[model samples]
Target: MTRKAAGNAPGHAAGNEAGEETGEEPGEEPGAAHWLFGDQLGPHFIDPARGGPRRDAPLLMIEARSVLRRRRFHRAKAHLILSAMRHRAAELGDRVRYVKADTYRQGLREAVGDARVTVHHPTSHAALAFVRSLPSVRVLSARGFLVTHDAFGRWADGRGTKHLRQEDFYRWVRQTHDLLMEGDQPAGGRWNLDHDNRQPPPRGATDLGVPAPYRPRESEIDDEVRADLDRWSRDGDVEFVGEDGPRGFPATRREALAALHRFIEHRLPTFGAYEDAVLTGDATMSHSLLSSSLNLGLLDPAECAERAEAAWRSGDVPLNSAEGFVRQITGWREYVWHVYWHFGTRYRESNTLGHHEPLPDWFTDLSPDGTDANCLSHVLRQVRDTGWTHHIPRLMILGSLALQRGWEPGAVTDWFHRSFVDGYDWVMVPNVVGMSQYADGGRMTTKPYTSGGAYINRMSDFCGPCRYKPTVRVGEDACPFTAGYWNLLHHHRDRFEHNPRMTQAVRGLDRLTDLEALLEQERDRRD
Candidate 1:
């Protein structure tokens, strides 16, 4: 990876002797064992210029079964992470010392003894604190993002904390990186084409009609992973949720690259228009299924954004499509990563909404028995079967339901982290706590993202055959979402009454003549 692509700055402590900083440049220390986390499998982690894992730096990889034992992760999520780590080990062959132990500490003791180890910055606060506490390891700057941590800190510091908006941050990133730019101006004369990307799915279409996404073929390595997962379950060592079907995402560098190429060549053109739309029959849509690859560190965000811009410049894809896709990686993805750290560890506990209800068994298990609401039921089933759904269903369908029901923000965040294939602590905390649940009280977003069935009916095909009517909210056939949306607003009326953005929604609540009956119905609702 290029120096510019990794967004790395010099002088990030490379070690020669246990916790002692070397005077040499990053990754240049000889005899330092380069430890690879599951999320840091890309070549940039060991790039000699970045730090000196040199051409032949010894590698340490630990597969701790306790990660699965501690939390009941989706079966596919467990399989994908382990497969990616094992695949990297197989690629490195003799250079890598792969150790499987019950805990990271145990694995480290078994693999490295007393040797000095250099590891890139871990993704979670817990992991970072643990590594910093370890005297035998040196932590380096994070990889796979477009902006450096220090750069983001400087930017955040310049702006006041509560008012740091994503649009402003996105524009700054575009200007700094010259992404989708025409000299000094943004291409197409606008920074965001989100308006163009909001169109609903094509009429009467079962799917997007685009070519299918790339799905990796399982090898013997996959067989071994499945067998081991099954064995662990049988022996009561680990537990998993969801179905363990054939692997659906890229697990190795080569496979990741292939997936990216397929997305760029076939799906990116129509990606922007229906980016937020959903088809019940089609889960993939025109979306790039590269989140798993990107989060796994198999692909760099800078590289991904640059390629999309290149496609626009070459006229292979429209400006909106390229710009929209670029904004995801360079703008939104990067913003969340920075926010996760800047918000501090206590951000997870922010519950301005004071929602303390626990999750229902059906919701936690991803069972359709939870609700007759077609959108919620279908989305849950999709996650149960595939460990994924596009972001719209995630935010609008699943998250919206949780918000309306007043589920605790931390529990919602953990559920998201445990369920999705691309989920990580850093990714889900900001997304669920701030964006999805609005529990941060306008920190990451302007307002709560919950909506009634009308929005869902407009954006997706799931409402057509739904047993509940989108327009009705006072009968047995009343849509849970339509009722829940107003019920939530009514319940929080004092909070929404003065906010300019919510005036229309708040006023609509006053027009509900059946408000008492609706409240009574929703209060007694179990399904």
Candidate 2:
């Protein structure tokens, strides 16, 4: 189905990809070699208008070893990225010039020296800067997102304030694209269905009986990726964390579409009620496991949202389910993408609360060997094994703990970027700095996303098997999160006390008779 472009809406701004003042035009010259970034493997990125389908221009792809060597990434993450890039290159055959080099500049020089290159805007600020430095490359508009850079810039600029509201942007997008809309209004006379969606895990259930998420079968290309990664590790050229299990995510456009169809057909109906819920055995639950594919640019957000809305229109899915899923794609995901650029590079360094603690070795290494807390241990182990966990575990469990402990936001941001398969500089910066860490001091979110043990207990099955007690904030059996939540509030009381959203949590600190003991315990707590 052809969806309406967001640019048709009034107030849509126009500029180059992600509108970063790259001093390049969105238009590309004819017959220029088109360079594909790892994330830009979709059909949209190389539409017939951009010298694809007919093979009007040769393709340039670089497998820069420096990217892997610079960071100790999750082993599975490295495998997925390499596998995806190689898979795309293989599909293109002789049309693509795939180069493995120490650096991108070397690869670019090898592929097409001093030739005019037309490439889609890169996802990272660093990549964009590098491309800008290269005189041969011409950057085009970014694909895979619902909103254009200029459109988002116009929307954000019209706000006349630094704090941009996601809900307002979401509604505007819904109207602009006519997604899930009935004439001029939303389909169900509501702009949000969050209240219907936040249900806890079913009582006594170890798993939600939802159908399994799509898991891609590894092919010869995958074997090549794994062997190369193993060789790199053996040569001491790159270090990796986590297990390199069978590739769990789609690495090609075909596989990505298959995953999206599977999600829309089998899982999206139940997604809303338990998207925030966690089952120890059911890591995916009813959630769509398409973040990696979406991030990889194998699947477009517009297609995903449109399919979900169609499901609702056909009555195969609930209104809440469709709206909730659409909100994530067109609302939160798009908002994060725009925020990453609009806030600029300096946003990554925001540390309004002045948190400066270092991440512990165990956490940084993604090892759960010594953790007694069932929620923390289980979530960490999940990440170590699969390089993924649901958003609830990510925000409430992992990101929450980091916030409670006051780890340095920049380090925490880097850890998140390296640890997950879908993680990227654009995706994690605003998310960690503003939403997860609240290190931006309420620029993107109203308050910190951290929660006490009760939240974990209510939302997931992990807490049931834990050694620590959720209600106990004192003694040896006291839950770290339960105590740490209060400790966090106490430490930041001066900053959070007067804030409307944080007033209640801050006031709760005064009710704690064991406040001093809790503080002492959290201060000494390691691991």
Candidate 3:
């Protein structure tokens, strides 16, 4: 059903024998190279020398309805992915064949027919499995990642895997990649500058400069996506959450680069210090907000790390700032991807703490004023409107609250995968299920990322504006997080008593004279 592009680039993989017998009939063209939805516009799609798609090679893209139906994705997330794919396809012109199919496998089958197909290995395990199952499909290694899976596996093998610490892996990455390194030692003399980066949100309005929100210029592609979404809503059974504002995220390479430069110039200087701060009205707060672009392959991870390192070496940005930023992409980002692949599908099913409560109703509510908790409501408002929030709010606020409430790990993981614009299975599974939820039994994290309202109070301005008291353990006006926190510790006392890192928190449980009363109060509130 797809037409072949005329002529071939010099040294093209397929060459002039486009109609050669690669499991096809006479005069039938060979299978087109299929780029999945998440494999949007990238270096791989443009430059053949860089293992990119050939200009003469037919390109296939499928907007699989199955994926949309799999979860209630944020409207902005859907728009971002779909629009970006369409935009890239249009940029590729007649060489591309875009199909809207009911399922990915069905789409690929239809696109290739009897011809032998070649596919880039997907980041998601599920997608990879699906591609591998196809008889005619040939899988190629996925590009755009800083570290290869085999290399990470080899590193993990050498480390021996007892307690897989990100710090150790991070150092290995730095030494191997030579990022932010001065000879053999790190540039700042210390491997981690995380301590320097832990300053709380700056007080007073004077320090809070004009919010430089990244509002990408709208194009015809966005209008085309908006129309598709409108039509889908009317005709399809698929449900979507969150808003689709035009001023949200950049879906094109040009806009992504602009956003990157904007972050380097404006945010990188203070990014490390304020990285964990959650302000009342400020959602971005010196954050790069480039994860979606980076994950989508619009920005290269190495380039991002090098740019930040350059800023630091030039004395334009601090070592803490630059090192912290580089660690995220080269360290944590690389680690998570490795963990996701290493652990396999079983990783998603892990529930060490056995959390089974349903997710709160307010998580998907379209209204900005979804809950009474000021901090949570603010973060959700940002996510619902823009499909993005800084990592602090994600981990400390949303993840902590859910962990305290004992929400089901799988449900929480799925919510994260659906909610965020940057979220993909490879990123969310290890992060939400393992790190945030501690559902994987501390495989991804050293401990459950749980905290009472006190931590939030110290780290952010959230507690001041909140209706509940951050310090109060139990009462009518006691913070839900505080109550839930005490309950969490009390419930897990036996398991945590031997853990040195958790000994202090476990010991605090002994100080509560009215422990039963507090637990009962929290239970009643939860009910």
Candidate 4:
């Protein structure tokens, strides 16, 4: 039997238990209905005035199977989200309704019964569209993000018709928030410490040990989730990848806080230096694995940034490390969210490059190791095993490879959405379709992030054991990335001729003696 939260309110019931139908009709009572999305589980939503649980409001949590069926989500990602929602409802104690339905719209209709409902604006575009379509529901602005919509709009208005750059926006956020700032200027006299970061992995660094993975202890909830997933797999009702093991992330607010503290003490110092480094065996290399919790609303982004800033002030960590950490939360995180809302739905469909190749089969499944390319295979293995790899690998390896090979932007975006534990529509679209793929025609990013194998060799250890040579651009032993790099330049040479950033690389392409033969060889290898 499916377990439900106990001790519900006197007038209400948990799950499908019988309760009074007094508020079943619309316009019957005030503050009678409130629904929460998976990402909006913070206590602030309960009582906005006092920031506590609302004892009188009827809370609803829905497990929508339609969302799961929309994409083949990682097994661990599904478990993490579902289990967290269940745990939140159980913790709320009373006046809570939890339902499992095929679609969110159906679930919301069932929960509301006949009462008028109020829903906070969702972080995702699809959810927002769904909530707006319901006649009985009223949508309110969401409360979790650090920057408000009005604030973001005002910032955008200041930019006028010109595209807003991340660096300028990042500085504005720092100055407005007074974080790591002295009066009107940055604390370190520099707005960015990015130059100090990006050091390659240190030799013999593997011997120093990596942070232990955050695997929560087994619970009844975990057992139930695992059973459900296994049943789905056996019955062929759902398709998911990755092993459904102990949830490798903190699910509750208290646990999230603990994880944050652990990261500050253990990983924050070296996070800046090795943030871009990619090693073969080590996945979590001095990087704060708090994005999942922050995105889920278990931890506030502002508070996390403030904590890192405080660490810098205390002299516990270097300015570069603290600044880098803070920049991610307050800068990139806020910027992307604003871009997603400002651009609206059409932003997702941007495909300026006009590339239309489907993603390779090896990306979806890595069983028996399909590819001979070590960098691709190792990174895919990390994702398949843990449902995550740091941003560097995402941008430099997986994303760059897709861009070089001219893969379909939507296909690449969908793969990212399904693969990561923290993947969401708002987060993936801007990062994948815009920044990583440059499919948005330099709207979100200044240029395409395409790179050769030399970059990979410089930043990572993946090239050392690879079968192909990183330096070769053609012939049988040529690294696919190197060959693909030249091919990509040749493909988009005319378009990027006027681009200042590509001028040097474009000029280098003229130096190729046998460009057509190299392109032909690359095509054959792909086929």
Candidate 5:
């Protein structure tokens, strides 16, 4: 629950008695007046304004889990959370129950009766805020990252706010549970082998281990969500992608553990080199698709990293693969979450570079024409279809292009949030807008990562059939990505010019001029 230190500020939106938005404004502080928590905002922060519990009746609340990807399952977390709520409410035979973010508003408390009502939360943040909102209602934390009230800034010490440089919290997680960190050194002889696993996978390699997917049958509440999703589609374009099985998700801890083990033994070996490599139909790279489970509290971060460490120790996977995977969990993933919250809602709105370029059309298209050669058409297709993209394409290509083109950091974050299956507000805001876009002034990553076609070609097979050539740096056949990379450095030379690690890239840029217009023509018209 948010502490009510109500000192009215200038830009705080004023909440009216009748009916107006009640949320933190885009440019305003998050006060009780004008902030309207609604559809467009993340589902995590959509509940009642932070207050306390309610004085009501009937103590049954249900949380149904669903993954909404306009891509495969017409999947939306909205469907799962609300559907489970509905099913549980119906099972208990209660009408005063059932709170769905998809179909309800924040006024549930004001409108509900004396009997205690139930509200469904798609994420831990939503649940925490919901509990904080009620006066006499029950509260529950998600099995996963639902830590809202207890704002645990792992990076922050007793001091004001601290930047998490080392893997302290992650180390504690390993030490506390006695995970993979084992050896004469710490837990193991070494802490991580991420740096060791950088060797590229054997080219033209096809040792991809088969990945299993679960598609569950629609249970009781799914009918309601399906109905809502169908209705939603009539208004615009919402595709339906669902799994076909009994209970689609890995409901318990065991299934999630199995998923992790599979990655450790089979996938971890090749994860690092190919972590950035994209291939057609290779949805799950050597990487483990465990973010959803981790976010939902289905798996522990320490446990996950340790398992990868175990893979390396057992020789099931290489050190580089293990270390790289561990870095994603310990370094990147947690760092992004911390940065997002530290920056707060404003993090998503940051545009420190002042770039207003719209995201390129290729971002929303299927073909590779006029697209950045290092781009992932499939991943972009996935984003548009299901709201999800794999890490490499999302980070390297998508993020790289955004940095190169000078798109508003906020817009890029929104695209990632709106279009990814795993796009939680805490995660997406920082990674996309702050880290990848460098809108946060190098908070999470080393630099803006403004790269071009050459980087893409080095990592993936997506460029082979691409409309443009990755090799060409100028003129018609020149890959837009190639020129874009140089142009980004050229345009932002003063910024990245002195960056020591960026020196090599700056040297590469030395060949190009500040003529971004000509660069654009070289890329855009390259047939």
Candidate 6:
């Protein structure tokens, strides 16, 4: 007879150090452990040894699908979840049991027979209707931060408090952990040293750090990636940007870290200073290429923060590097989240200037022999060629184009998402609309970051062969950005012109009495 077990220490328990669960359910009886299959089986798999209603044994269940699409895509998420669950099950040994039902109704049918089954996968609404419809059953909201809505365990304490917005919530996190607050009590006493660090380059050639790419060395990952790529090959236009000359790259956590370590050591010091500047043959532009790692949750936030901060504390890196890195990890990243939740789903729909143009074809189509090439064409081509656009191009070129041309924020927002590998809702939203578009009523950033083509002309060699001249505004060959520069000012004059910081530029435009007329010519160029 298989013996059941009580609680084994699992890393899922908050205070428990991160590692594998140690399952040793003493006094657990056989046949006590029970597993319920939710609509979606979560990352953690259940143990079959000691699952039951006893103290040592507990119910385990899988969750349902968040949404259904008839076309099934191979879920890398599923593989990870299943692997974690199996690892947990091995750790917990006993009479632990689970369901193999395909549909929620079947799982529920089994759940009905076993009063010990606490977890469930209600595939159909009717399944849940039936289960909760019965007596001695109850439902409660989840306590995890991932909760979309509050049920019984809801906390209203956030209302009208420090949690009123994400900046406040992030500040709370900073203070709680003493990150960049003030004085010796703070972790470095400097909120930010970015201003000093963000320098333009002198006349010299720069070196490119070796890009960290990987082949799937882990046998399980390699085999599964091959299978999954084959399965997903027909989905959209999936490019296999991998080693061995495949364009696809690392799709797992282990390889992501290798990319990160190389950045921290080779690129982080110069990141903030030239993080925005773009140059020829400079694929990464002194930026730490760890955005995807942190976003995918492969790297824990606190741990990364501690590692970067610790490096600074040990005198391994300067304060500018440390604070600049912290701002990316702690300040801006957290702010992006708060802005999204505060703004809500419709935030993406904003069109501050009511522009209805499609994203410039330069975003999708490239021309080998055309002269009407967009001012942004060179930069958009950058992303298309390498799935990357450094900060300045994103903010100045793309953002400026959208704002000046009056494209719907949503249209440009979608463009931002599709063009980059790191484009997720949380990060991209604030970046696109707020920093990029200034569409969020100017909450995330104070000023619209726009400029004539000279800014790019000065920083990059791209201007030499660009279809339009940065200096010419009225001619057919003029950079549209230069002409649009004046039009944007005239268009938004009342709202922004009088502001002290912006008025200087507006006054400069006023001096060119024919500015409005030249601006009109610029609009014609877009056609």
Candidate 1 has a TM-score of: 0.95
lDDT of 1 by residue, 1-527 (tens): 12222233321221211223234454356788888999998877777775546677788999998889879999999999999999999998999999999999999989888788888878888898999899999777667776767667667776777787999889888887778887779998999999999999889999988999999999899999999999999998888899989999999999999999999989999999999999998999999999999899898776788778788888999988998898898889888987888888899999998899999999899897688888888899999998999899999999998899999999999999999999999999999999999999988998899898999999999888999999999898899899999999998999988878898999998788999999999878744
lDDT of 5 at 14: 17
Tell me the lDDT of candidate 6: 0.51
lDDT by residue (tens digit), candidate 5, 1-527: 11111111111111211112233222222211211121112222222332211222233332222223323232554454344445434543542344433222334433353434333222324433545566543322221221221233422545343344436544543343344544313433666554554444447854455454433356546766667767865665455432212334333344556777777766677677666666665656666777755665446665676567667777777666776776687556655554554555455667767788776655544334444443555555555444445776777777877777777777677666545545666777767776688776665556676566767777666677777888777676777677767767777778777877687777776555645555666446432
Query: Which stretches in model 3 have alpha-carbon errors above 4 Å?
Result: 1-36, 53-55, 210-213, 366-370
Residues 151-189, candidate 4, lDDT per residue (tens digit)? 566667757534788888888778766778877889889
What lDDT is obtained when candidate 3 is compared to the true structure? 0.77
Off by over 4 Å in 1: 1-24
List ranges where model 5 is wrong by over 4 Å.
1-97, 100-155, 158-163, 166-178, 183-190, 206-224, 235-258, 261-266, 269-273, 302-322, 360-374, 513-527
Return whichever of 2 and 4 wins on lDDT. 2
- lDDT (C-alpha, whole model) for all candidates: 0.86, 0.86, 0.77, 0.77, 0.52, 0.51
State the displacement of the C-alpha of residue 420, model 2, in Å, after optimal TM-score superposition: 0.5
Q: What is the per-residue lDDT of model 6 for residues 428-450, given as tens digits with 9 covering 90 to 100? A: 77788877776765555656788
lDDT for each residue of candidate 2 in 1-527, tens digit (9 for 90 to 100): 44456663211222454554333433437668889999988887777543232257788899999999888999999999999999999998998999999999999998888988888778888898989888988766666777778677777776754459889999989988888888888998999999999999899887889889998899999988889988988999899999998899999999999999999999999998887888887889998989999999898887889899899988999999999899998899888988888888899999998999999999989989758888898989999999998788889989999998889999999999999999999999988999999998888988889888998888887776789999999889899999889988888899998888899889988788998888888777743
For residues 1-527, what per-residue lDDT tens digits would candidate 3 score against the true structure? 11111121111112111112122221232434646455546755345554454445677888888888888999999999988888877776787788888987788777767566666557787787877788877665555666665556556675554467899888887877778888889896999999988888777542446348566887888898888888888887678998888847778788888988888887899888877777776778888888999788788777788889888888999998898899898789877877887787888999888789997677756355767777788788888888888888899889998898888988898899999999999899999988899887777777888888898988888778788889888777788888888899888888877778899999998888878889889878777
In model 1, the Cα lDDT at residue 487 comes to 91
How many Å off is the CA of 424 in candidate 6?
1.6
> What is the Å distance of residue 152 in model 2 from its true position?
0.9
lDDT of 4 at 261: 89
RMSD of each: 3.1, 2.4, 6.7, 7.7, 9.7, 9.3
